[model samples]
Target: MTTATAFDPMSEDYQQNPFGYYRAMRHEAPAYFIESMGVWALFRYEDVVTTLRRPELYSSRDWINNALGEFDPVPQVPSIISSDPPDHARLRRLASKAFVPGLIKKMEPGIRGLISELLDEVQDRSEFDYVSDFAANVPVNVTAQILGADKTIARNEFKRWTADLIRSGARSVLPQEELDRIHRSVNELRGYFTELIAYRRIHPGDDLVSALVQAEEDQQVLSADEVLSLTFIIQFGGAETPSHLISSALWECFGDPALLDAVKTDPDVLPLVIDETFRHVSPVRFLGRTTTQDIELHGKVIPADSVLLSYIASACRDETVFAEPDTFDINRPGLSRHLALGMGPHYCIGAVLGKMMCGLALGMTLQRMPNLRPVADDVTWLPSPWVRGLASYLVAP
Candidate 1:
């Protein structure tokens, strides 16, 4: 609508601190096209929410396939994230059954125990990387437990596979060799899930994989490919987003003494603190969609099949939505309005699980490490266009 802007997401300045860039886009170009990325970027809260909610108008199917031209083969199994109704509806319903409230509530004791054990292992160290020592492992272990994965699958292996899979999915332009590596990682991850699914079929357990194995839709069960695809989505979604969230929440606390003191003094506000963190520093920065039909938005006409990037991170900080949008205030009113977990049909299926893991991780960290503080102001962030998270955050107790 406004004159298109040259927004380079991969630029050093944007990667290091995107909030300023996001603010600029929200002000100057709510629906501006990024010449470099070849996608129309939506930054306003209302615009992003509308685009996400109206998936019928803006489809996700093969959006990445179109964007990743000549890079690597398009994924064979389109997960729920990439599907449209009635297929999307069917897959989501079946998957939702696995993450019902009762099952997640049952996971609390195990989640707390895992957090305690991790804190114990790091308690002796004077300084440690929050991401590696704590944040990264929690979700992988939790997801593994929920999926009834073989304990033989190393945690580090899970982390590596998940990270590669996520990198492979991003719109960022990566080198050919790196893209090839990502492709190989994708195959390895698929093989792992295939083997896991086969085992679960023969020896079913009270876990998500087994549930998906038996999940029926109108007298039809999910195919092997469907199960594998869903497994891939669940593993990465459950692991990466929540891990980033835990680290981001802690990063916020460590950077603000008053915030840290508030949480340490009144742990009751831990959930609110986590919510505020999600609003202020959403882990998943943006999601891609394709225009299903030519549409007019904010005085711009986006043609059919054009790629559109809905910047959730930017929307969460929209001045129109939140009072003091940039401030990390736990008690900010109407925090639920934030689109951190997305909205409408494709709202993150793993939202509840992510919250549980993050809440426990933060609560336990504050309790166990009473003197928790950042080791340095320099934090290394994961280099990806879509995911906003630190690769490592140095901290000391």
Candidate 2:
């Protein structure tokens, strides 16, 4: 097996900008083994796709659990993203009903109004950290709206919980205090959802959580644990990814003068810009998978039970599949093939909602502020192994 140069995802250098490392790994060792993490990372698009397509051979039962450090008292149940076939399929099918494109489209009017309101709050300011002032707020509020928790939970409180929950994935490398905070966040989410689930039983509302609480198919329904598991993942997933996506799109556009000019001139290019941002700035860096059987690729044999990390961020920038992979080109024809939202049966359930939020937020923001631009040349990236997003993106209007 090819062993890549000391690969530590926890390193600050790698976390800041992984594209350079991804580029080297793609060429030198497509399937490299990281000794420290005991994981074989697939950097090539072909290899990543092959592994993602065959979940039976490469199970997901413990992938997310391994990525997100396990809690001490709280048992990690198999959620949709962390379950293998049959169970995964069942969970996805039932959970997906709440996220159907039609249902998400129904949320468009409300989401647009929400975005407008958020923009209004920042309108008078000459500059604002888009990540905090706007991007961050959009997803949590949308998630609250979806879960029917808007009225029960305050916006700032929900935002705080979502931020802490997303960090739970980095608990293994985090400081003791930070780790404890993440655990608290986990407990809070569990407690909140546990109570919400119980309350929803009495007062079912037209929200995703309520729907999942009562979701039934083929005379089979999701248990309370199942509902909690799905809600936990969906809550954060729905909150974190889209926020990063919106900020990343703005970052790319403002940084590229020509792209920004084009966008300003032709508003229709906004969708293309967002799609390309998904490829250029993949929010979720990589997803872990456990091998069910021996698999040979790139002249190496990966043993069963090995933690295989498919760097979808790397796959999205695979030179073979994407021409000028590093360059952010909105017109890239292969935009449809990017694995930012993931691939296979475990694809993001909130994909439709995510794209809509991004497009709406960006389109509205740019339209409202004709002179929007970046406040600095550099961005503060989130220092985490699981995602690639700005810690704060300062922008001026």
Candidate 3:
């Protein structure tokens, strides 16, 4: 008989060393069932790659919300990520029109400037918390400005809300107080976007909300909730993931000296280093979906109505995909395809732009900072089971 895996995810020493546990799962149970959560986790690269691409067959239908009976993964407002089809297509076009290529291109110089400034403040200090002082603030502030919100107000508020939402959702069940708080935040977030949309409608700025409001004026349109949903999605998704990725990437460089030296010396290796970092140290770990019909994989059937969770972080380290699945090799090839931003119809809208942000900010960061290394110990994880990022990485120059 196969001995069962532990029930509580946090019960494992995963926080201390998760990769070793993931590697074991790759062989023992590639398409294993997480008895604790009553959800199935797909660990190997091949399985994850296939599942992410076939949102049609697997059906992102109710899956986007990642539901369990009477429990909702997201709040009431449904964004494109939670949608499939003609609705998904329509919403994408609406959002895409606002998320213009020209706007992203314009963001490049500002990112470089922000990175330089952050590094400067840290230079005088022997040790500094990288995430709090630098990584966490920059992306969200930029996203808020783009989304037509006041950066200062949104920055502090957004960070608290996102972090709280994570802790509340990490469990199979949340307390009533937690549930109440989540709902309260959701209402506030909606109202917050409602006000911003109103402001953009009259004032008209170069930001994304102004662009969406103009789309409405053009006889192209969206509902009040849809507008609010898109705005919330843009600000939260854009801010959370990229900031997590940057801090996590820096942590990888901290542990590996040779990789650090190579990055310090070579400008050409920047892109690959970023790409590999996505694979090695994933920011968002698992996202769930409730399958509408039965599915078969690895000679096992996942019955319909089951909650399927993709171990996105584990997939990146699948031996079948990368040469040294766990190593942070700056020159590693096969950079073209990575699900770090996800895939298919609901692929991350901010992906290209997020990549641009990472390239510019991290590139500029290491360039000016000079001899930057992790301060080691006293670094803190956000206490999020979902986003595997530091609350801060103390840095010393």
Candidate 4:
């Protein structure tokens, strides 16, 4: 008799290093149901990819809100990440209007400057907290600059609000205090974005927010709430993942001397290194989707209305798909094939921007601090079942 493997999202063993647990699920329980969490967990690469590609069968609509058990009293605003079909497409179109390749290219110089400034602040230190001092600052500053919001605002208010909102969203269950904080953050963010949207309406600027304000579809402009929702998603999405990606890349590289040497010597390989990092330590670990109808997989029937957790982190490291799956190889062929940023209609819109930020940050770090290395093996990671990111890493250059 095969004993079922137990999995718990809140367990410290899983939180510390989930890759082993992922491997177990992929091998022994490809479609394991976690009664405690009330979700079906899919870990195999093919299973995750199929579920992501078939959004019609696996819907994202209300998956998060339902999991968190929160509903806004106000009419729901169309959201790019939380909707399906026509609504997702519409919100995506409007949001993409502001993230054109040209605009992202235009921000490159500014992004580089901000990266340099951040490094300059830490240049004199023998040791510094990589996450708080550098990694955390880059994406928030870039998001603020892109949105035409004062960078000062992002440095504090926007950063705190978005961090809390994301933390709250990543949990399987939230205590009353956390739920209250999430509510407050949501209200604060709405007010902040509403004000910015109103300002953009009167005084247009050459920034993402202004572009979003003027963006039209079928001769229809976005409603105030829609605009707010888009900005909220953009800022929140922008801030969290890339920050983690950069720090995680550094952690992986510094832990491997050969990888660190290669990254330091060859700037051209930085993108590849970033890609490998995505596969090895994906910033967003899992995404939730609700089944539209019953589905059979791995000899088990997942009933309709069931919530499925597509473990991207697991898929990226599936031994069936990747050789020596746990090893972090910078030159790994077809690294981009990993589902770190997701797949299909809900694929991350900010993927390109995220890669750019991480690449530049990693490249600049190598250039500025060639001798950079972690001060200790002990690192603090954010306690989120759905997200993977270092909270702090003491590094010395």
| Each prediction's TM-score versus the true structure | 0.93, 0.94, 0.88, 0.94
lDDT of each: 0.82, 0.83, 0.71, 0.84
Candidate 4: tens digits of C-alpha lDDT, residues 1-397: 2233757877776777788788878888999899977889898999999888888889888654754445331237646777898878887887788878998899899889999999999978989999999999999998888888888889988778866766665544568887778788777777778889899999999888899999987887777888877787788789888999999999988888887888888888888988898999988888888999999999999999998899999999988888887898876766778999989988998888889999999989989999887899988778778789997999898
Point to the candidate with the largest lDDT: 4
**For model 2, the run of ten residues with the poorest summed lDDT:** 67-76
**Candidate 2 structure quality by residue, lDDT tens digits, 1-397:** 3224845788898899788889888888888888877788999898888778888888887866686657522254677888888888898888877877777878889889888989999978989999989998888887888788754473757777777766666565679998778778668777988899899989998888888987888988888888888877777787788889999998888878888777777878988998899999999998889999888888999998888899999999998899999899888877899998889987877887788889889888888997988888888799888899999987888
Where model 3 places Cα greater than 4 Å from the true spot, the runs are 1-8, 67-77, 171-178, 216-220, 256-258, 377-382
Q: After superposition, how far is residue 24 of candidate 3 from its true place, in Å?
A: 2.3
Alpha-carbon lDDT of model 4: 0.84
Q: Which stretches of candidate 2 lie over 4 Å from their true place?
A: 1-6, 72-76, 151-154, 173-175, 265-267
TM-score preference between candidates 2 and 3, better one: 2
Q: How displaced is residue 124 in candidate 4, in Å?
A: 0.9
The sequence of per-residue lDDT tens digits that candidate 1 reaches over residues 337-383 is 88999899889898888887898899889888888888889887877
| TM-score, structure 2 vs. true | 0.94
| C-alpha-based local distance difference test score of model 1 | 0.82
